[model samples]
Target: MTLTVRALRAGVPEDAEAFARTRRATIPYLVCTAEALAWEAAHAPAGQRLHRLLATGPDGTVAGCADTGLLAGSTAPGHGFLHTAVPPGQAGRGAGAALVAAGEAYLAGLGVRRVHSWVADEDGARRFAERLGYRRSRQARFLGLDLRHAPLPELPATLPAGVTLASVADFADDLRPLYEADVECAADEPGDVDVGATPYEVWLRLNWGRPDWDAGLSGVVLVDGRVAAYSVAQTDGVDRYWSGMTGTRRAFRGRGLATLAKLAALRRARAAGYVHAYTGNDATNAPMLAVNRRLGYRVVASEWRHLKAL
Candidate 1:
């Protein structure tokens, strides 16, 4: 079938839905919705320069989608991200190649010095990136948990003194505390770009404000009345639950607060009828990987970071 490429323009509601559907098919481990995708594109910071594209087969179905932009969270400059995905059985066509070419050209025009992409370590995706002058770097894992059957850790019947479990809803009156903890946690995360500089406003818009974000299910750990750790929960409006982000402050690292936060969130999600849970982790993040393993998460898929000098 022949293919055509075009920008995923705003106000075009169908494109968002198509992209979301294709994303679900292309990467089942992650949770995404049309509303969340549209909101992010509309609310992203100006510097983000978020550009989205869609590839349509001759039959008028969405064969693939791509997005590229400058990394908004990094304090440094000239670093951007690229990702192009096509549905299963649609590879070998020109859709993926065309999308990457267009995405790279757009970012390069913006003077992006470097571009990064995550290529799934399967189905010749890594080879595809290599063909495009992208070199493999660090690897990451896509983890999944069978929440309906997996034996989750039992929560302690009694809480430690001055400690409490809370949710994003608990801090509806003030989100800065959560933002502050997130900033600190992101600083230590291993990645090509530093995310410690994510602005409060951008966090509010791109993260906390997403339509799929479950404020009531997302758990936070409190120590002496201060936010110490958090687990952001997102759902697909069905039974699937995904951990958007989970992190613990440096001072609270050894205390298992991050684990505590995730446990609380997962328990709440399972009780609420969610059957599956998914999360991603940098392969080098031993602490989080150990936590996931103890909690029965397995690496269902892996992807490697690929970089190119524009």
Candidate 2:
């Protein structure tokens, strides 16, 4: 039962795939792929101290994995994040503990004084976080929709006046407008962490450059030539698809623009052969939750944001 926890060797395809496998086993609601994992490791913003760790058993099998780092966009000092995943049967083997210890030590060395982690809202997960001195802060639900079974909304035959639906690829030449809209929407997203205005360069690298980001599947709503609402889509290039982010600018909130944008994105995803669609939202986001519920997205899992002061 001997185990070793060490930093993941970036650029090594095998290690990246193993790490992705562990994540998928532990958190299936979120999308994970070897290419996406490698991209995050290699393209993380310069200010964010990214550390990917792997827990390996004596047989060289990956028992668990962790992604930890400081929130580079946070204006508040000492804010850090650590998310660890250990498949069900591997929990008692000390893999979780080893990863947590290593992750905390790594962040602490980088001057992080407070760390945050998201633990699935289950008995064992809560107990583990409590034992590690983390306290619950907020909750978020993971929702899933079976594109092959559930009925989706039909696209309106006529477009609303001054409104047009388009794919993200249409803006390939210039994404500034989309970025501006995203920054505004992100600031209003419910969460314990305040990721203040995200810089265009950082957003471009981490989000726009993501391997799973399918521009054709991403939908945007423009009002009189201005971006009003948009949905970012991510896929595993298989059957799994994820709504990376769906939001509407404050000025267009109550017009159902967000819902329209998401519906368009989901339809595109289904047409593209993606069978499973998933998204996550904070429990306090009633509007978004209602929108997902109406779209037949059922709650599959929930996680509690846990905070620990170092």
TM-score top scorer:
2
Error of 1 at 148 (Å): 1.4
lDDT of 2 by residue, 1-310 (tens): 8899989997899999999999999999889999998888888887888999999998898999999999888879999999999999898889999999999999999999999899999998999899989999999999999999889989789989999999899999989999999999999999787778877887887788888999999999999999999999999999999999999999988988888899999999999999999999999999999889878899999999999999
Distance from true position, residue 92, model 2, in Å?
1.6
**38-77, model 1: which lDDT tens digit per residue?**
8888888888899999999888988899988998767678
Clashing pairs in 1: none
Query: Candidate 1: where is the Cα deviation over 4 Å?
Result: none
- Scored by lDDT, model 1 comes in at 0.90
